[model samples]
Target: MSEYEFSSDAALLDGDWVHRTLREHAYWAHDRSREVQDAANAGSRCFGVYERGTGRQVAFARVVTDGATFGWLADVIVDPERRGLGLGKLLVEGIVEELDALGLRRTLLMTRDAHTLYGRHGWEPAAPVGDWLVRWRH
Candidate 1:
């Protein structure tokens, strides 16, 4: 098995690596700027998964939370080259575990095509999707 280590420490995160991965791979953040990404990381509870021993960061995620009532999981990305190793599932699981410990009333996330992955970690589709709304900025 490939050993992995998970952490919620922001200081251990590699901002440049994260920017590159999200900008190139994540559909939600393909146009996200480094400045915005850095700011987001600064404000949220960030998580990273590193390959044990090598200390190389292989995955990243963040949660916007009040530490009590709510949280929104966002920017979950694993190195494309490292997919199929179960990193994404493991990362989401760890994030959910942390959120659950906070006693939050609800946690939300939006994904274009990762429902199955998130479903395995206890996430379910929010019914009446129309009740949720967003305003996009161009």
Candidate 2:
């Protein structure tokens, strides 16, 4: 049996777990407000990874897509207590499968530290550092 399982059922996601992980642990969303987080959850395709025996969520990822040709994978994080067991891989692989099923030609993500993990799953730097520009609002 697999040690972990992935589910795209957003209903299965524990909002408290997700909020705390992002707010307290994940660098990317450490200052993100709960209201914004809830809104994001409402808008994206969310995936969660759980331990097989306990069904406790240990990792999460979300994709914003146009349902046709493009997607952006974001907010991927693994619970610190559960890192290094390949749950991140399982989570990303599950998301990729779902995105592929949607027939998206390109999916993108930005990470300061997970390039190797994403690379193992077929993600590469998007045209080198300065080649891409992002305009942030707020």
Candidate 3:
């Protein structure tokens, strides 16, 4: 389901299919316009997966990083129609490679689902953030 192509010159960050893809992936997406605008402007490193031959995006993921030691994965999504295809793993594998290239040794994320997928990549549960407000009320 996923085959990531590394591109430093990513397509410009814009609303473009950001929100639509979110909805298509069954994420509780609200305010399509806002979701698109916010994510595109968040300044995170984004990985976009395109369907072979068609060049249409089938998955999306973003990583917020410090470019040195840490990268936190967030907002990983794959279209519902493509769910059984292993697209999510490809998105993450791409992010891992990018962060590794940038010399980041610590990659982190919080997920309530897909634990087995992450575990397959050798990630294990660790202590949660110390007194951190991990949720977004927005």
Candidate 4:
């Protein structure tokens, strides 16, 4: 209902927002602050959507890639209250743009329950998934 803006600057990710995103990812990140700081320090690609006036981050996504031919999406989260408001789609689109910029020919990601959401963005289950053995997903 309010103005929405998206940015790729980690500077936009404040402590409170970083904490919330990390808490939401507690399952995968044993130490959230470390992850946030690492991402910042590594110059990793990250996306955040914020409320207009407050600049409060409400959605976030990041990618790990070699800036070449492959891209992996990680840490994509939309604030529960902000879910279904198109932030996720926007974030993924941003990631796609990043991949294009990197000259990547293909991108890969795994989502437990967001197949449909990712499908809306043209991502579908890869056939012959047998190629990559299921190890551990975190």
Q: Which candidate is the best by lDDT?
A: 1
The parts of candidate 2 lying over 4 Å away from their true place are 128-131
Cα distance off (Å), candidate 2, residue 17: 0.3
Candidate 1 lDDT over residue span 1-138, tens digit each: 259978898888999999999999988888889999999998899999998898889999999999999999999999999999889888887898899899998889999888999888778989788998889888
Cα-based lDDT at residue 64, candidate 3:
83
Q: List the residue pairs that clash in candidate 2.
A: none
Better structure of 2 and 4 per TM-score:
2
**Model 2 lDDT per residue over 34-57, tens place:** 899989988999999988889899
Tens digits of per-residue lDDT for model 3, 1-138: 324343323573334566666655534554456656475537787777776566667677777888888878776777677787777777777777777789988788777888998898767887675744666786
Per residue, candidate 4 scores C-alpha lDDT tens digits across 11-118 of 887656655665665355445675665655366577788899989888877777777877777777788877789887777777776677778877788788889888
For each of the candidates, give the backbone clash count: 0, 0, 0, 0
lDDT for predicted candidate 3 compared with the true structure: 0.68
Ranking by TM-score: 1, 2, 4, 3
Q: Ten residues in a row with the worst lDDT in model 1?
A: 1-10
Error of 1 at 95 (Å): 0.5
What value does the lDDT take at residue 30 in candidate 2?
Answer: 88
Question: If candidate 3 were superposed on the true structure by all CA atoms, what would the RMSD be?
Answer: 3.3
Residue 81 of model 1, lDDT score: 95
